[model samples]
Target: MNGFTGELIGTAILIVFGVGCGANSNLKGAYGKGSSWLYLCLCWGFAVAFGVYAAGQFGADGHLNPAITLGFAAFGFFPWSKVGAYLLGQFIGAFIGALIVIIQYWPHFQIAKGKDDGNVINIFATAPAIRNPLFNFLGELIATFTFTFVLLNLGDFTQGLKPLVVGFLITVVGQGLGGTTGFALNPARDLSPRLAYALLPIPNKTSADWAYAWVPIFGPIVGGILAGGLQYLLH
Candidate 1:
């Protein structure tokens, strides 16, 4: 497996576990419905760890995130030539993963119809608890900055026990800073699945909230770049 294929499969797995957990917690009639925030965080963390492992095993760098790829490239930690392939893989994989979740939760979606259970879009993307766009953007920036900054120190996070450590970092970040905008630290993780939700036919769906989409798309990229810049300065 080359970079594109590895990234594609890895990101698909990431979305499968992460968004599957979202569907389990948010959709009605699911056994794990109304699960706690910590559960969600842990599941997402594990999702990323496993995705990284898969990507590394398949011969990619295990980014699964455009911000990581771009940030590292900007700082010369990664190659610029591969950015397009990695990004394409990440977006496509996220869309596929979201589709899988929709299919897996189809029954729950049917039962959730007209029930006011929750917005189906949340299963595929993030939304702010409060609808302040500026702060929401800032929240994502800070969170991703912290995440990427620490990740820079890891150096080849896909090796040995580093993936688990990365998972632990995600859990802590979610628990600590996720309350604001659900911590969409990766644009592919947020935007692609959101696009899927908007375009796909899922029952009990609400507005895809395209209005707030810029926060996740631009915020994490900026945050990641800043982290890489700072890392460069320090090193």
Candidate 2:
């Protein structure tokens, strides 16, 4: 497969597992309902690992997150020419993945709807636990900065067992820093799925919370850029 196809498929896989977990945890009548935060973090981490493996197997760099792609391109770690293709694939794939989750948890959504669960939006996107815009943005920025900086040191994270290491990184980040803002460290991961939640038909859906959307989109991008810039200067 080519880079575009690889990224699309990989991101789709990521969403399948990650958002599916969200559905399971939040939606009523699911076996995994009300799972712990650690469970959610681990599942998301493994989702990322499998996504990276799939992307690498299909001949792409496995940047399922636009922040990473743009940051690397800005610092010359990745080619500028491929940034558009990667971003397109990531966003489109994220939407597809979210749709799959909706289908998979359709019954659960209906059950929740019957009980008037009005905040199902969290199943598709991140939300601040405290609703502080500035602090929430900074939370994402600091978390993503730490994530990207460690990722830069990994070099070729898709190779060998590095994907597992990447997964571990995600888990630790979520565990340590995810409480305040749900750790939306990737714009494509947060925005595309949130958009899907907004546009798609789902029972008991709430507002897409577009008011706070900018935090995830710009925070991760800025964080990634700063991490890449620091790495570039050090090198």
Candidate 3:
């Protein structure tokens, strides 16, 4: 398969596990409702690893996250010519993955509506725990910076173990820095899912919160660039 196709399928699978877990945990009457943070952290970690493995199998680098693709391109680790394709694939995959989540949890959505809670959107996207845009942006920036930085540098370690290390890195970042903005280190992960939430007809869900959308998108871009530049200097 081509890089674009690999990225698309890999990211879709990643989002299925990542967003599906969130839906299972947050939506009322779901089997995994009330699951703890550790569960989410572990699932997302495995999600990234699985995505990488799947993408690699199809001859792609398996950068299911746009930020990683951008970071590599900026650092000359990836060809600039392919960045657009990778990004497009990632976003498209995320949208499809989120749609599956909505379908899988359709009944729970109705139960959630009865509660009338405004956080139903949390199943699809990230929101600041503190609701401060400026600080929230910074939180995403720092979290993504840490993620991209570690990802870029992991090549120095054991080649066969990089995927597992990346998974643990995601878990650490989510548990350590995710409290602020839910650690949306990938723009495609946040924006595409948010778009799905906005476009889909889910009752009692909160607005898409477009006001905070830029934080995740732009912050990750800036963070990726910073990571690439830093890696360049260190190398």
Candidate 4:
């Protein structure tokens, strides 16, 4: 497959598992409901691994996240000409993946809505455990900085180990820094899914939380740019 198609499918796969796990844990009546945080972390890590594997052969280097694509492009690893296509594919794929999760856990969504414990948007997107925007933005920025930094350097050490390295990187970040903002290291991964949660007709859904949306999107872009600039300077 080409770069666009590869990124599309790869990101779809990532969200299918990533958001799927959240739904499994949060939505009532799901078999895996109440699963531990570690379980979610592992599932997301595996999702990244499998996403990279899915798009490994493509030209875009399996950049299922917009930050990765932009960072690589800014660092001259990826072509700027393809950035739009990659972003399009990633966002679209994430939306579709989230839609699938909604359908898969339709019954659970209704049940959770009835309970009204809180917003079910967490099942589809990231949120702050605490309500501090400064800390939340910093969390995403630092986490994504680490993410893009390690990703940029991985090419020097191994030829084909990026998938596994990135997967583990995600797990480590999730474990160490995800408590604040759920570690939305990718704009597409967060925003598109959030958009889906807003647009989709899930029963008794919560607000889309647009006020905090820019944190994940702009924070990661800022982090990606910084990481890319760092890599460029180092080279």
Using lDDT, give the best candidate's number.
1
Question: Per-residue lDDT tens digits of candidate 4, residues 119-182?
Answer: 3778878889998999889889998988889888777322377687778888988999887899
TM-score of each: 0.97, 0.97, 0.93, 0.94
**Candidate 2: regions farther than 4 A off:** 114-119
Sort the predicted structures by lDDT, highest score first.
Answer: 1, 2, 4, 3
- Provide the overall lDDT of each model, using Cα atoms, as 2-decimal numbers: 0.91, 0.90, 0.83, 0.84
TM accuracy, model 1? 0.97
Which residue pairs does candidate 4 place in steric collision?
none
Native-referenced Cα lDDT, model 2: 0.90
Off by over 4 Å in 1: none
TM-score, candidate 2, is 0.97
In candidate 4, how many Å is residue 45 off? 0.6
**Global local distance difference test of model 1:** 0.91
Which is the winner by TM-score between candidate 1 and candidate 3? 1
